[model samples]
Target: MLTTTRLDRDDAAVLVDGAREKSVEMGIPMSIAVTDPAGHLILFEQMDGAKVSSIQTAIDKAWTGATARKGTHVYNQLCVPGEPTFGIHNTNSGRFSIIGGGLPVEVDGEVVGGIGISSGTAIQDLEVAEAAVEHFLKVQANQH
Candidate 1:
């Protein structure tokens, strides 16, 4: 069997809005994005005063997490003391940036999507993403 599932604009928008709101609530500007299971951008937004560099980074985080079907930084957990992918910076591509702030979005415990937020400090970025994920899980939980 073969199948593919993608996040719609509305769903993506909700994530962006949720992430952005949380960023604002916490007094930090942010660049937020949602990616489909294939790691393609579904929705993206930049809050005022956010840096441009955050966009690519945010999308990369989401894609890495979603495609890997694990935390974006799974590599870090698996890497050796000096593994090339260890403490990977922006250079490595395809599922690297596992330093928190990015998470896979799942349904029935299977990752079907992901959300990424950047433009703030690492802690702030992770907080925003975490809040969004928590809300998403709650919504899904209520559905069943």
Candidate 2:
């Protein structure tokens, strides 16, 4: 059998903290979700003033990123009209999204989990998610 890395509670907390820091810096209230490599939710948070509707979207974004093993922006490019992955968003009961704000967390080039952010503009969401992933990577690097 093959082996894979997973995020523990502390790791998930680190990711959430990173995303929250970026959201605060940008003055954007956000819903943040972190998911395991198998696309199961590990942690989720909605900041004050964040939209309730974004809760599900944030979870779905993390699920998509974890399962797809790439940033959602890449999926956006693939799922556009005339692309090879067109109509992908229509699958998974519409849970799949090709939007920005989803990013996979990698350790030594292996995707261990994913982070998603919502309740702001697409760019803001993406920034927060990226910040979380970056923080995760930095912490991993320090452990070695």
Candidate 3:
């Protein structure tokens, strides 16, 4: 038998809340998404004034993060032409995001979930995503 850890609703909430706070601090409304280890969405939010087009982007980003088990930004470098992972973004029905702001959530060296943010620049979205993950980890650490 195998045992695994996964994020629940409360955990997803923490990620969303953290992302929202950071987005507000940055003066950019954002779309945030949280996903399970399997890349299934657990929670999502789009702040007022956020771009409507970014909603699907956020979800796809989370999907990429969780399923790929790597930050989406990492692919931007590797997914270029002639690279080994070239055309990766074309796979998974085009759900593999090469842009930034998609991050896997790991606990005890195991990926438990993913977080994705959008609506600002890629760098800005990445910053908010990082902040959200950091906040989630801190909260988890304090609870245990």
Better of 2 and 3 by TM-score: 3
lDDT-better candidate, 1 vs 3: 3
Off by over 4 Å in 1: 73-80, 83-95, 142-144
lDDT of 1 by residue, 1-144 (tens): 987666677777767777877888998888888999888888888888888988787887887778767765455466556776555544445345766678888876667788888887777888899888777666657758
Comparing candidate 2 with candidate 3, which one achieves the higher lDDT? Answer: 3
Give residue 112's error in model 3 in angstroms.
Answer: 0.4
Models 1 onward score TM values of: 0.82, 0.95, 0.98
lDDT of each: 0.76, 0.90, 0.94
State the weakest 10-residue window (summed lDDT) of model 3: 75-84
Worst 10 residues of 2 by lDDT: 134-143
Candidate 3: segments with Cα more than 4 A from true spot: none
Ranking by TM-score: 3, 2, 1
lDDT by residue for model 2 over 1-144, one digit each (tens)?
998888998999999999999899999899999999999999999999999989999999999889988888888878878878999989899988678899888887788888889998877889899998888778878888
Scored by TM-score, the top model is: 3
Residue 13 shift from truth in candidate 2, angstroms = 0.5
